[model samples]
Target: MTSRYTLFLCALILAAFNLRPGITSISPVLQGITRDLGMSSTSASLLTSIPLLCIGFCSLFAGRLAHRYQSEKIITLFIGCIGIATFLRFFTNSPWYLLLTSLLIGAGIGIVSPLISGFIKRYFPTSVAPMIGVYSTSMVVGASISIGMTTPLQHWFHDSWKIGLGFWCVLALIAIPLWYTVIRHPYTAKQETVQTQPASLPLQNKQAWLLTSFVGIVILLFYCFTAWLPAIVEEKGYAASYAGMIGTISMIAQLPATLLLPVLLRVIPGRRFWITFFTLSEIAGLAVLCFTDITPIVASVCLGIGGGGLVSLTLLLPIDKTNSAMEASTWSAMTQAIGYMIGAIGPIVIGLLYDYTGSFVPTLYLLIAVGFVVIVLGWKLTQPESSQLEEQTVYQT
Candidate 1:
């Protein structure tokens, strides 16, 4: 690769690294936030879900935004938004204040998500799978680092969670300058002209919705683990710090699957076999949590591998089916909108179910059922040798 291409590649990975720390960092420090703000578990859960909801809402407009302006510029602007939101967390004295920050962070992340997919398609068309592997792995790495370190940071700051929560702002701040460098040089002037008005979103296509639902279900499974794994372990009599480590371990376990899924996709492009295997792993993890007396760590490993592989697959689906960067963005935006909206339900539902039943057992059962549904939904998701873009002729815009 040329030097410019190398820079853009590094920029992509760094930008992705910023994506999850804002959300996952909260999990390790959730108890401290609830205690400090005098909020209930249900209320605290919103810190994670509200961003997801905003991601879903903001995702609808990502294509329009990217088409209207320089995508790199828009991305840099939003990365700044995320940094500002994370910085504001240091001053959060009320639940509402913290929630407002979550809204900003989510909006920023939502817009960035689809645009990055387009960028991967635009700049690295031949290498989308491997680049996506890098992308998804960066996200998981971000989650692992944030979940693993936030509690320790809290302890280092004399048990102040605000410092821990606000620390991630540095990541966004760091990403801004590097991404801005990409904006200084355009890929091609013709590329900009072509994107002036790309095709409308694929809302009416059966395949699109199926892809959306699969994205939603896998995301729901992921955020559930991201939001609750720490607390679930803590409830089993472990110290808060140890529970946070469990969550970290789960995220760490995902790295292998994230890095491997792209290679596997090249060898086995069809989704059926991978889906069945990953979802079975998920079912086993949830079953352990629901019925067995095994350590939650074991369950975390299984869930991590399962959730990791499935989510990586979902990220690739829209790209695989669409033909161009703009088309990928449109499909990605639609899928992310519905997908994240559905994902938003995971944390809140688990929190409410736990609050209602005074136990996480029922929630684990619900997640297992959701896992089975994913397997069923994924049964038809075989990647074809040709683009399915022409098949999505139902609705536009």
Candidate 2:
């Protein structure tokens, strides 16, 4: 398309990239934060869960925010808000203050999540899958870099976790100006309304629910793995830093998988086959992770492949199921809003299991169960065509 359109797409992807790493980065350094703050594992777990909970709840308001204000403006403001929240973490010692910052950061990130899909639908109508793939890939890159660097940055700054954690604020700040430039251009602001056609509700559409459930399960698996894998590896006798590095490596695997998925979608008519393949891959990867005492490097490769593929497929489902960008965004919001609520529970449940059993086996077993559920849903979602029913949900704006 035009240079302007290309630039806008880059801006959107950059924004997407910024969304997750900040949150994920904290997990790697949770030990440091826990030691410094004198917190319990349950409290540490809350730090991860609180953001996810907010993301799920706040996503419901994302569409309304986009409707009331220009989406670009809302994105810019919230990203700036993210920067502020990140900066605040460096100064806080109290868990309450940290929790409040988590809420702010999570809400800011949540507002941007659904809007990015909607923005893509509105701006790059024909290129949704590739663009979203690129977006998802960027997110993985950012998460990898953030997690990979946390320990080194902490060491470099004289073991000051605050400085290590605060470094991500700079990335958030960089996104703001790029977002402003993109949103200011008239071409990016041309508003197009979706033609509303009444039909059956998306929830009533088995295919749509299947797609949503697939995304939920994938996210559930992904978040649980990210939240606990480091500790799991540590339990297996690896260093904390090594465990964190493995998590980073696992996140990096998404880059290739996400980039390839869009191309595959074009060649493959039925999404179910691909979904089934990836879901099984996820199951196999988790099985290896649990059953094998392989080296950290080898196990990480398996985990990364499974985690990356699952996340890429989750983002791809909305675009695959919808005919237009509006439908895609709406479906994305609904699925993510509902699906993520379920996914957010994974880490907390895993944490509770760890506390009760004092072993990672229960958590691993739970993940394996989630993987099978995803396969069941992915099999249904892979159907060659959209359902005959139309979505009946009302757009609140």
Candidate 3:
């Protein structure tokens, strides 16, 4: 690989890293945030859910925006928005204000989510699979680091939860200048512009939607686990800090899976086999989580293995099913938007159930059942099919 290509890949990876840390960083600090703001668990869960809801709804517009303007420019502008949103969190005292900020932050991430896959397709055409693997791995590393550090950072800042939550803005700020350099370089601009309108509306293709739905289901499961697992562990008699650490461990386990899955794709045919295997692995993880009161460490590792693999597989699906990066990006956005909308319900529903029933058992059971549904939907999605007619029929005014 040439030096220029290598640097562009690094920039792409850095961009991926910035995407999720903002969302995941809040989980570990939820207790503090709730306490500081005098909000209920339901409201705190909204803090997490609002971004997810925005990610789902805002993603539909990303393709249009990318078409109207350069993706690099859109990415840089929204990333700056994310930094500004994070910084603004410090001044808000009301739950509604925080929720509004969440909407802004979510929109910023929603816009960038689809563009990353498209960028990979444009710049690293020959290396799509591996580059995506690298991207997913970088995202996992960022999420893990954020989950692991937020608590300590809170302690360091004299137990100021605001400081812990606000520190993640630094990542967004750092990414802006790097994104600027990547977008401004004439050579990089030329390479990206060469394929500006690559086929992104894979939703118009039946096979693409099948693959997309499978990817979406996986995302639904991934969001459920990430958003609620810490709280679930806390229900199992662990401290909030320990539960947060377990969430961190679950995210960290994705490193190996993300790094290895792309290579595995080289040898694996029949995408169904890989999809079914990981979907069942996720079901098993949730099953273990539902039935066992084992040590937090042991349970967390089991859940982590499944959770990490599930997310990695979801990200990998776009690359596997599509022939071009534009398709992958479009599918990524559509799936994430649709799936995250579904997944956003998990934490809120779980919180509501706990509120009414005064127990987490029913919620855990509901999640386990949802895992089974994910497996069924995932299997159907793994098939090479598309929904082109459906999309066109719906889109035609």
Candidate 4:
């Protein structure tokens, strides 16, 4: 790789690192945040769900924003938004302030995530799978570290939850310089001659909606369980620390697969077997956690591997199916916007069910049913080999 590609590659990996740690870090210590902020179960659920809603809403405009302002600057600015908001967590003792800052953080993440996808498509189209693998790997590493370390950090900070949360701002500090370097050189090929700009979103296309739903299902499963998994584990008679580590397992397990999935796809090309197998792993994992108490470790690892693989697949779908970086960005932004909007329901519904029934059993069952839907969708969404098509109908914007 040339120096430019190497620098941009570093920037992409580092930026991926920032997008998730701040979000997943909080889940491990969510109960503490609630208690400290005086949040009821319902309000606490809203705390997690609200950011997802912001991510979804702000993501809808990421493509246009990047087009107007340019991708590199827009990404840097959004990462700036994330950093500032993460730092502000140091001062936020009130639930309202937390919510407000989370809104800003989510907005940054929402915008930056798709742009990162676009960046990869532009700079590394020939090696999309491996680059995306690196991207996904960085995210999971960040996420797993935060979840695993938060409780210890909280203890080290004398049980102050704010410091545990605020410490993640350093992620942004690391990312900003790397990304600044990425856009400083003209990385993306100038596509001025191509008619890539769309008249409107291609929501009317069946494939577009299919891609949207595919990611929607993934995010719904991801955010919902991530938001509440620690608390649920604790309620299941595990200690808080144990629950937190177990939660970390679900995220850490994603790393190997994130690094492996791309290579596997290169060898195997079809997405159905991978998606179906991992989705079943998630089901089995969740079922083990819910129905039997025999091996929580095994269950957590299964869930992690499954959820981690989906992250790779969902991110890949837009790029795989689309023809150009601009098209990939547009489809990715749309997928995130629509999918996250739908996925945001998981936490609220799980919270309401938990509060209403006084058990997480119902919550687990609901997630399992959702997995069945994911299977059906994954079955259809699996790309038929290009060679299999007599004539292709490409999704156009």
Q: Best-fitting candidate, measured by lDDT? A: 1
Rank by TM-score, highest first: 1, 4, 2, 3
Give candidate 3's error at residue 242 in angstroms: 1.7
Model 1 residue 205 distance off true place after TM-score fit, in angstroms: 1.4
Candidate 1 Cα misplacement greater than 4 A, ranges: 189-198, 383-397
- Residue pairs in candidate 4 whose N, alpha carbon or C atoms collide under 3 angstroms: none
My TM-score estimates for the predictions, one after another, are 0.94, 0.90, 0.90, 0.94
lDDT of 3 by residue, 145-169 (tens): 9889988988998987777777888
lDDT of 4 by residue, 259-359 (tens): 99866765665678888988998899889978897757888888888999987888987787676767788888889898988888889899889889999
TM for candidate 3 is 0.90
User: Could you tell me the TM-score of candidate 1?
Assistant: 0.94
What is the per-residue lDDT of model 1 for residues 218-241, given as tens digits with 9 covering 90 to 100? 899889978998888877788877
TM-score for candidate 2, please give it: 0.90
Q: Supply the global lDDT for candidate 4.
A: 0.82
Ranking by lDDT: 1, 4, 2, 3
Q: Candidate 2, residue 320: CA error in Å?
A: 3.0
Provide the overall lDDT of each model, using Cα atoms, as 2-decimal numbers: 0.85, 0.75, 0.74, 0.82
By TM-score, is 2 or 3 better? 2
Q: Write the per-residue lDDT of candidate 2 for residues 1-397, one digit (tens) a residue.
A: 4788777877877797678866888878888888888887767777777787777777777766666667789889898988899888778777888888888888887778877877777776666667777788888888888888878888999998887777888878788988898777746355566444422226676666766677777877888888878888888888987888888877876677777777766566445666667666666667776888777666566667767767776776666566654566566776777777778788888878888899888788778888788877765555345442212211111
